[model samples]
Target: MIPLAGWLLAGGSLASDPAPTQSDFGGAGLWQTPTARMAEEGELSFTANRTRPYSRYNVTMQPLPWLEGSFRYIAVTNRPYGQPSLSGDQSYKDKSIDLKLRLREESRYLPEIAVGGRDLGGTGHFGSEYFVASKRFGPVDASLGLAWGYMGNRGDISNPFSIFGSRFDRRPGRDELPDTGGEFNSATYFRGAPAFFGGISYRLPSRPLVFKLEYEGNDYRSEPHDNDQAQRFPVNLGVVYRIRPHLDLSVALERGNTAMFGLTLHTNVARRSEPAKVLDPPPAVRESAAGRGADTAQVDWEAVSRALEDNAGIRVSRISRRDAELFVTGEQTRYFYPAKGVGRAARIVGNEVGGDIDWFTWVSTREALPVAETSVELSRFDALLAHDIDLDEFRRGVERNPPLPRREHVLYRADPPRFSGGWSLGYSQNIGGPDAFILYQVSAGYQAEYRFRPDLWWSGALNANLLNNYDKFRYTAPSRLPRVRTLVREYLTDSRITMPQFQLTASRRLGTDWYGLAYAGMLESMYGGVGAEVLYRPFGERWAVGADLNWVRQRGFGQDFSFRDYEVATGHVTGYFDTRYRGINVAVSAGRYLAGDWGATFDVSRVFANGARMGAYATFTNVSSRDFGEGSFDKGIYLSIPFDLLQPRSTVNRARFVWAPLIRDGGARLSKRYTLYTLTEDRDGDLFHDNLDRIAD
Candidate 1:
């Protein structure tokens, strides 16, 4: 049987297999062992499973073709990490991370092969490592593999690696108690006695249902906390029902006595449902251009600015005309797509000015910093408006140039207190911790922005608590470092109405590719700071660099503008890269964190054509594991959904949700309101090309 391991690896299956569906364990699996199946790229899945002694919640994503990543929280029903007298009845909840890599795809003659590690980080309560293979025949899919560590605790057979040394006969025991739990314990991997686990899944004919049967691997003798469970039979049976295209439900009878149930919700970030749009009518094409008696010199530039705002979604700061070219310097205010906004503004220019105006130049600006200059020829505009023209060809004819070094002329300028506001209802929660099993808050907030100048603005937000259970947030994880964070209860319970942000920001365009900003006031819920940032981004480039420095004082516990004595100077030198592969973007930053710890952070996100984004980030600092406490480093996942995905009209607003396992002091970065990379996203050539279908709007 030990030699069979080598033979199995050399043998091949006879048919190609389809991708596997998620099993009760959240990844592609049958029962206890994972199968050689991978989810579609950009797929995000949330799964919940419950059995006798454990409940698991998983967030899984397939960011690449051969990789699957899952972050999970497991709750042990009968085990408590804290005494009941102090922390109320709470089950021990542990956070674990898992990853699987596919080595070979199923072909006509070979089975799909994969290797994976479960519970790779955190306490090794249920950790295991395995190599598995699967093949499909008609509606029946079969999987088989050998598992080590906790999965093979039954010791049904001798360790195959023992041939190398007797030390490989027994797996090393994990430290029962560790100061921090996020480190991977690699010494014990593949060192234990191995056991066999296999299963078969059958799909019901023409029905959205699947049945599975598997042989157990573990004997349940080494359960956490010495609470070993009883295994009456070694076989397990299960069934899964597809409730909807994005939803699934599963149930299983395990060990002849225990029952398990699971629910999964899945979505693909790369695809979205197109909504019916009620769009503004396109600008009317000029009929007999010579008949419209419009004087270029006598045009009401102020009213023309107002017309541009109302019709074209462009807020003109200054307008100038030199020779046959009319230049409008402004910011985009409405359309989410920059090209659509520029095209609309150009059409408005052709309609307001006479045909003698040979060119319309749009100077795209942010905080009065010129980002790019777009020149549209009147001839190309007329042809696109009247004739059947390819938008790409027409755009090629339009000139995209760097901003001019000097201002040509100032024909008109307008300064007004532009007021804009909106309100949203939000809910936040913390789960799977020794604190309360769940602490949550529901709040409603309103934000208002007043633009005093093209480069200066004031903004503030006030949130009113509608409902909350923050009083239950009493338990705080132990930490040895300065408490830069982990004071959630103090901050959440300080006031019913809290102002998270109120600031005045001034920005300037230092050069065509350089921009700068200075901001001060209450920056966030816990910090009040003055900061400055500078960025250098070339037009239509794949990479850029930036640096930001801030001097911040902690806010008072009352959630007011008063400052605390705790202050820090922190900043990062960051680089941004567009991989130009599957719309992936990567950012790397290295700097001193809020806790005075030096560290680096890596972030990778995917932006769909519709502007929806999904990403995850991880940070590691110089702080020792003992000082950092549980979750040795900071890590989280986030999703940014565009408002237009649900609304009938397009807008620049987005609803963002982020989740971090533990809020420790090791690697905390300042959460600034804006960044130059985001502000100048439109300057990317791919963005304009992706949204060219909206050129007419």
Candidate 2:
């Protein structure tokens, strides 16, 4: 009469605790499983149970939170009559499923620090656990764990008539080899000892009940009965019992060599259920009778900026018919967390605009500027020009701008018109330069994406700009334009102006199986900067990976200086409204610098998915004149498929060429910019589809 397959059920506060008559229950118990939260949002659950012989089921799902998908099932109910029935039906059934996720862990309010990818289902397929980092020094509350699993099934005890006398490893042996190979083998196979264990658990603060102490054991394979390796050890003693207010109850006692006892019953299920006469009422009298019967609330700041640009994407910067007098200019930067000798640079400006010839739509913004808040004073080697027009063929390309027709007689090889210019700037060496400082500026922008739902995806932009500074006059050798330096002569008469700026940006994509995303915004110089970032990709493989970081802050007007430990501010006019407090003049140099700038970039023909293609890359940049310098270093190694110039097709003399051997400086010489030969003779030459006639020729 051992038909006690109770499949777990032990509700909380069991008679106010203390009443262990039924032999203290047996190890690892706390059943009453059925967890939930929020109801919808990709739900899933299952439960099944049968009788005779066997039949059980359990299933759960979420899809993301680092992913978790569980499964369990068992079946067996007949056969078993002769000498352990070799293959003549003696009962067989067992199937399992476990696919847990979370490649990284270290966030219990940051316990010393941790980083991504934890057990990508390596050892023993499933049964992964990790907790580490613990503290409660006073009354104990310890923690430290790392357990792996694969003991898969050890159940079932039912049949008709036995031969009496057999218990192998459970200890009763005395057959000395009989019953045809000890009852037809089969003590459950695959015991391949895939071990690795480390454990620690503590808790003792009793008041109504609390006392836990655990110890784990492991050592895979050393033979204990076929299938290889077996060394066990387990210890646990528990008693917890808060009992109410969301309930909880525990009961544990385990000690290797087959001793076990358990019972648990925790409950919360997204708590909330206690307001049946607990002082309720008064939300200003339920909103004063629905605001005196509705209607009378007006403040539609453009429908709250189009409901924050369609439910929290916030992108605002409309006004650009090429240049409707720059009403949107932005610059807000900050990243202070490095201060010893000093070295940090930031300058981001992204834009997007829409309407006309809808190359798929727009509205964008991105601003990040603050290298001492330059008001022009730039020159390291500069030259610029960039453009993009598709406002529906932008007035038919400005009514056929440029000697009518020349853009390949009506540019439109499936929607053309995108441009860009050349000549970047750099140079800043007080000691062989390259210690970071290459600000070559010049831009023109517009980008777009507007979808309310389609699994929800969004992006927008707009940009307008110009700049040409040869980095403080490259090498200052031929210097004569008011030049004088005793330690930086009033920033050399500040003269770096070509100001006409603007920017905007937006993004969104949230939940379905393990989804998440949210972002905030703002950008409009001297005091207009805001930022946010988040990402989670539950399950998508080919060695999938995830993690992201973002931050921003700013203030500008210019007149602050302090070099010895860094501190610059000399442009003050603060009191909040139209505030001002300038940039740069902070110097207190130390050690820890890994300045970066490794040239060499070549990409010829593509084919390297596994080997060979003629590719070359090397770009490492570390900046630190003071703050823990080693803050940057990008590794590189590349080689694409070229299999010794793979034979394809070539025909130049008759207007058909596919030459690709582009290399950047290894023997010097890489210049070919005759205004991109009038944008590859106007169109379809596919040099990126004449990107807006090479930025408006």
Candidate 3:
């Protein structure tokens, strides 16, 4: 039997085992070494640590139960970015990507096993690969691992894989790679002499603390840039305190003399929460008079439409009836969770139409285009509405469908709102290759859209710099291909107040599963373009296909109406797939790019339970790696965070961040403001199907 003494409640229930906390280097580990333990899936952690020569900022994500990923930036205070003349006195900055995969789960008799790589696709400053196993016994959790490369610099053990080939005994040093970084360095992975590392973490009984002691494998004698330190002993000691519900503080003594401190701010994206919606009006449920079947003309649908919009968050454009079915079609305005709005619409219609209606169908639209249809049987729903049946049981009678043709009778029609916009703070970061030449800008941005019809609108945005460090932007664009995206530096420092976008957009529902979008204006900061897209997404399907075409001219340094001489016709035909399991979404696009290059781009992302999306993408074209310059190709990671997750009220706004290892001009696409796939996100996907159980929430 497993010992209960070591198991303690973390962010989960008391029955759940104590989960691993963030390591100083930004993953789940003990002191400076990693363990086989993995954080709970869908958790995001931000960690900052300071030791001696290095300070690190890391963002780690658990996109899957058995997978972990992290992106970190390490600042080497003792090292300059480059020659002092070019980089000034700024410290050196190195970015790294890491990934871990679980091979086996911990059982009563077996320890958990995991294999991972650090600094996999970046500069090999901290490169290493390892295999680890961990187990728990009473109050102590023990781990042992073998590592290669930087972490295994001690090299006490022989190369076990060398027997197979001579190449297995050789590991390349960092000096062999390009200084611009961004390479996978797969040839040297696990090829060096290995070393053993082990550690044990003790959870204090009834206390929110974990005491850790570890034997590190890295001797620090072969540090990059010759910044080596003396290692009197391989042992390190540390302790982590749960200072707050969402905060972790760790202090450690490492390398026999150095003092280390780190803090991690983390949350489970799978279980995000905000203040309750107690202040918002509840779902309105009008009762039938004297339990009698009523007439259709007696219902004031205009009032019902207003109620649906006000309380249910559904903007009613029209209401119809066919036999005992009442159809209410409108755009979803407020709720990101379709189930919540559908539930409220059902209650409002069910109560207003009385016993005469047997089914309620709410068709949700994007712009004027129908996307998803939710039909709820009144009899089964009444039980749920009354709390007699739980949500799961009530969902049995629920049906999700595509938008159907107009019903028999029209009851109400109202136009959607004519204006929508907001003012928000925006931040952008620019990278002029690697080696710490980064610049950031903060701006006050205002965007508004004026609608002429439900399917047509004109939108524009103006940004004024609030705070920035543009004076430090001194790097020049490096591109052998057409200068499609390399003009970022000029755009960043051109003008403080600029209008990046002012566009007219229109969309149409071509067929039951077809959507078309067209827009023209200043498309993005780097380019001015006109583009159109069409998407074919079947109802209740996991796959979709789309094609887009655009003609674009580069925008001027002033970001105004003036255009540049460079122009190109670029487009792509893309296929999108959603692996409904584990919230993974994949898309592949192939066609001509902005720089007149032909290639394919592959994008993969994970959607957390709270609507946050974390994704990575890569592009490879006909251009050779040497011509494409450092990083070999184009690759980046992006995170889209919904604003509602941190607000007191609900919102459809999001904060998007994209970090490319190095910026280049190959395989670039026009950055359009809206795409058909994004506008019709609620259609025939996981949004409604996976959330059917929340109909009464």
Candidate 4:
């Protein structure tokens, strides 16, 4: 039997093994020793219980003063799996790990402030979890937490309900249960929710009673499979009773996920230390501004991705989930004439937003522009505001438009702003291999523009495609990158052109960091290109240098089918530079085109960074394939710098600038750039100029 001397009493009762009273529920306790005392703490607890057909075991330990960890693993090997079991068979297993740490605080301030991390055991599917923080001041305590969680089961539990009742003969001789339901994949059961939870609780002064309340819910947009856009809120109330000097019991009824009845025992690890009366140190004099400490280190892209899905189920399975969003864009270009239309100025504005909820609907309106232009403006605005709202994720989506598309053309007054309204929808699901998945997307949009060559002309394009990525082999275009980011490759096609194209790509790991890949895509445009590249890593590292060779052919209005005139071949050597502090990557290349167009190129970017990031790009191309234009060795240069303006403690501010100069014949060709800004969460606008050479000439 447990000793009773270590335990204290509440409300005049002194039972040998006391039950928790209402006071102990929320952090309320009567002083047993001195009113003000210092103390060290260490504690451990283990519980084993049998809830009818199933048995559970749980353990909690605190190895450090500010850290608490808990582990719970459950296994049931019975046969009756009806009702809650879903699977009639009787084998269910799950394990979870939870860790929490307290932050440092002054003696007079709240000391219960803490950060929490959780990882579900290798049971359900990939791992899923959340980050939470809480604080308590005097008789009041409150907490807030964000959770990105995936709920799904892992390996099949031997539950009678899960067994296929029709397929297996089950004539008293079968050992393995036949695959009946065929819906065992975790994807079928797992649901994704982005939840925010916060609540307040208060204690009654001088009484053994405490009152507490909380609210929790998720904000989830529609995905390819599930379109439920709903939020949940629950409430809870509980009380605790202190039996002896060392034992405590508690019970609570909650409408939310934490609803449970639990009993706890508390003991003084060591006698409370005497209160100290040390003199307060004088405040240090303020000096010049100092670099913020690591605590001020901002959350980068990698941190956000890791927090999204970190679970055993997610780590083990090869299933992927995707979301489809639709948006509309409108932009206008203005041109400024230098003496005689030598230079032009332009401006672009757009509003985009749309999503589907499972049962309802969701919509948002925001602005978007190329990265180079957005980063610059954001930097100035960030210095003005005081918060950090991620704008890079949006910038990333806009950069996929090939660098030269529409950017090389000069603006005309007769033409209206570049106004386009388009819709894009895509969805992808993963198969069961380690990293296997299938994806598809359909996009169609129209733009109204006055064609300079063909006066008063308008045109539009429609797009549709499917892609697959499994543990075995996958295929995509050269423009496509690995789908490691969000399970979806941003490119519509690979490196090859795709009016209507098909491709197959496969790769295999040779060791740790070494891998080999092969890809082939068919093109439908009048012009087509066939190319292949090999990647090699001598030391098996994440970074590597490689070379590629490509031969292309083009058919123009007048083509005699001559190699010297219509066929072209080129070779390029490539290397990558990765930056961690600034969250950027630079890919540099030196290549030669058969048509005397040989130059070096560097494509660098500040991918995910705090404050702001800028990318300076420089490229020179001489001579162009007749298909592009009728010109002799032409020299061109382009530059763009991007950044994220983080307010002191608010959403991000963004801006950027892009400039390209081309020297043809003895003058500049289409020399100009643009600047874009996104001030509101879902609003965007921009300003641009053309014929910039007028300033130089």
Per-model TM against the reference: 0.89, 0.19, 0.93, 0.25
- For all the candidates, what are their Cα RMSDs to the real structure? 6.9, 29.0, 4.5, 28.1
Mind giving the per-residue lDDT tens digits that candidate 2 earns over 1-697? 0011111121221133222111121111111111111111112223343323333343333223333333333334352312332223334333233333333543455332111111111111122222223333455434443322232112122211123323221312223312211121123121222222222223344554656555542322311122232334444455555454223344544433333223222221111111122221111111112222221122223332332223222232221212211111111111101110011010001111111111111111122110111111001100121113342343232111111111111111111112223332322212111211222434444444343432122333333335533343222221111111111212222333211112233333233211223332322222122232222222211111122222322222221111122111111110101011111011111111111111222221221111122112222212221211111111112222211112122101111111111111111111111111111111111211212221211
- Tens digits of per-residue lDDT for model 1, 238-347: 99887666667889998788998987766665465335557754544555576553677677788878877876778888888887788988887777776777777877
**TM-score rank order:** 3, 1, 4, 2
In TM-score terms, which candidate is top? 3
Q: Write the number of the candidate with greater TM-score, choosing between 2 and 3.
A: 3
Tell me the number of clashing residue pairs for each predicted model.
Answer: 0, 73, 0, 91
Q: Candidate 1 vs candidate 2: which has greater TM-score?
A: 1
Q: Which candidate is the best by lDDT?
A: 3
Pairing residues by index, what is the TM-score of model 2?
0.19
- Deviation from truth (RMSD, Å), model 4: 28.1
Worst 10 residues of 4 by lDDT: 342-351
How does each model score on lDDT? 0.78, 0.23, 0.81, 0.29
User: After superposing candidate 2, which stretches have Cα over 4 Å from the reference?
Assistant: 1-61, 64-120, 125-149, 152-251, 255-316, 319-697
List where candidate 1 sits over 4 angstroms from the true fold. Answer: 1-20, 155-169, 278-295, 298-304, 319-328, 357-361, 374-387, 390-395, 398-400, 406-412
